[model samples]
Target: MRILVLSDLHANVTALDAVLEAAQGRWEQSVCLGDVVGYGPDPNEVTARLRKLGTQTIRGNHDKAVAGVMPTDDFNPVAKAAVDWTRAQLTPEHLSWLAALPPGPLATDGIVLVHGAFQDEDEYVFTPAQALDGLLDSTAEVTFFGHTHHQGGFSYQDSRLEVLQIHPRPTESFAALRIEAPRRYLLNPGSIGQPRDGDPRAAFAIADLDHQTVEFWRVSYDISSVQERMRQARLPEPLVQRLMLGR
Candidate 1:
């Protein structure tokens, strides 16, 4: 079965919609790596849509803060503001769902799902040293992570760890990675709501472990519209600006 892999949705329903529409009919099951709600306009709508899809999900740092499961003390001023705003905007039902979301390193559907590193859900795995723990310790050969918001992966086999260049180009729809048996992988699907890999397009992935290939995808969405909504909601200007910049 082809599995839809999504992460760092960050409450941008428009971007999520564009991804779903673009990926429709190509996936059999769906899983979200985390941050279902955080720094965008449609917290409730995104949560409700995921609920309706029955996607297997895990919570991110922002989700934890918004749900009151974690503190915003570590958050920067801008992130703290977004967290406060998201907490206020989330519905009781959505808040409960968000609160109850399990921390990752969750094993399901033949693959592992993690918001960040396998050892620490809140930690960012951006380098080989940071990624080595998860690559070595994960139960599954192919484990997926988010939070860095960059679409790439790390692989290990013969005492060597290699970072995989797996992102699709701006002109391409998707990039394919062939998963090998002896080698294990720690991959990121990038961010859907707010990409930070210098690509403005919404990012996601489709995994077909049975076929031993995963497709990293980038799809264009209505960013101007989403930015407008963020402005109307009085969200932080920096957040609004970064969406378009994909910083």
Candidate 2:
């Protein structure tokens, strides 16, 4: 079955809509790596959409903070502001759903899904050492994670580690890679709502389990619309600017 792997959807429904349109009829099952809300203008709408789609999701740091499972003390000022705004926007039903999201690493069909590192759900596995540590500790051959929002990950084979990056052209929709045996992978599909890969386009991945291949896709959305909403909502300027810069 083809699985749509989505992560870090920071409530930008426009980006999610574009990704869904681009990936239409291409996936059989959808799994979210979390952060369904927080940082964008449409927290409730995004959460409702994900729920309607029946996405099997894990909890992200932002989700945890918004749901009151985690404190916002560690968050930056802009993030705290966004989370606070999101908290006010979410309905009781959506808030309950967000609060009830399961923490990862969740295993399904031999693959593991996590918001951060395998050892710690709140950890950020950005460096090679961190990724390698998680790979060495994890028994799962394939682990999909989000948190850093970068569209790449590390592969471990025979005690050697290699970092992978997907720098697709503007015209290109996706970059495909084979999932070889005897090698363990820690893949990050980047962020759907907020991307920090220096590319403004929204990022996601399609794992073709039947063919043993993974395709990383980047889809462009209406950033201006999201920015306008954020501005109207009085979110921080940096948050609005980052969407255009993809930082």
Candidate 3:
């Protein structure tokens, strides 16, 4: 099956739409890694669309804050403000939907989907060492995770781990590696909204089970509109500026 892996959408509808449009009927299943809300415009629209898409979404830190499951004080000052604004913007039904989201790492069919690290659902596993540590503890051979908003993967070979950086260009083809089925891996699909990897484009992943390859894809959307919305909504200017340069 072809699965489209998405995470850290952070409620940017334009980026979400860009990802769906780029999928172009190639995906059989849409798997969301988490963070459906936070630090972006159009939280309602993004959440509603994902619900209609019937995505397998897990809970994100931002989602937790919006649902009031996590303390707003846990977030930074600006993040706390955005969380407060996001909570006010959401409907009761939307909050319920977010409240109902399950925490990860979830296993299905041979793949493990997680919001953060395997040890903790909220842990941010951004480094190769961190990814390797999670892989060592996971049960699934293909463990997909999202949190750091950086696209990368780590594979174990001959008792040594090799970290692979996911090339964002769709035109660049990758050779399928012979995965040992029961071994473990930790893969990040990257962030859809507010990419912080020095690239402003929307980031996602396409897992082709049949081909044994996970292709990371990035698509450009109207960042200007999202910025405009943030300004109009009176959200933090720093958060709005980050989207432009993807820093």
Candidate 4:
């Protein structure tokens, strides 16, 4: 089955809608790596959409914070502020659902899903060395992770690990990666709500592991509208501004 992989959907409904529209009819099922809320407006709206879509989702750090599963002691002031605001905005039912989201390294349909590192759900895997453990220790040939909000991953074969520089070009919809056997992979689909991979477009991935292929996709959305909503919500200025910059 073709699977849609989403991550870091940090409450920007516009971006999420754009991605869904672009991915329509291309996927048979969906899974999320988490961060379903936080850093943007529409926390409740985004949570509702995720529930309606019924994507198999895992808890992100922000999700944990908002759900009161974890403390915001380590978060920066700006992030803590957004977390507080997001908490205030989410309905009791949505908050309960977010709290119940399972932490990942969740295995299903022939791939593994993780919000961060395989061993630590809160860690960020941004370097080849950092990605090594997940690549070598993961149970599946392909493992998808989020949290860094970057669209790329690491591939390992014969003990040689190489970072996969995979992303759709500015004018393209997706870039395909041919998944080869006897090789372990750790991939990031990027952030759906706030991208930090130097590209403003929303990012996601479609995997057809039976065919040995994965497609990294990027879609354009109405950033101005989302930013305006954030402003109206009185969310952090940095959070509102970063949507357009995709920082």
Work out the TM-score per prediction.
0.99, 0.98, 0.94, 0.99
Q: Per-residue lDDT for 105-147 in model 3, tens only?
A: 7886558898988888888887677777678877777988888
lDDT of 3 at 10: 95
What tens-digit string does per-residue lDDT give for candidate 4 at 1-247?
A: 9999999999999999999999999999899999999998989988999899989999999999999999999999999999999999999999999999999999988999999999999999999989999998899999999999999999999879999999888999999999999888999999999999889999999999989999999999999999999999999899988888989
Please give the clash total of every predicted structure, in order.
0, 0, 0, 0
Q: Candidate 2, overall lDDT? A: 0.92
lDDT of 1 by residue, 78-148 (tens): 99999999999998999999999999899998899999989999999999999999999989999999999
Q: Tell me the whole-model lDDT of each prediction, alpha carbons only.
A: 0.95, 0.92, 0.85, 0.95
RMSD over all Cα atoms, model 1: 0.6
| Quality of model 3 by C-alpha lDDT | 0.85
Candidate 4: count the clashes: 0
Better of 2 and 4 by TM-score: 4
RMSD of every candidate to native, in Å, equals 0.6, 0.9, 2.0, 0.6
- Flag clash pairs in model 4: none
Question: lDDT: which is higher, 3 or 4?
Answer: 4
The candidate 4 region of ten consecutive residues with least summed lDDT is 237-246
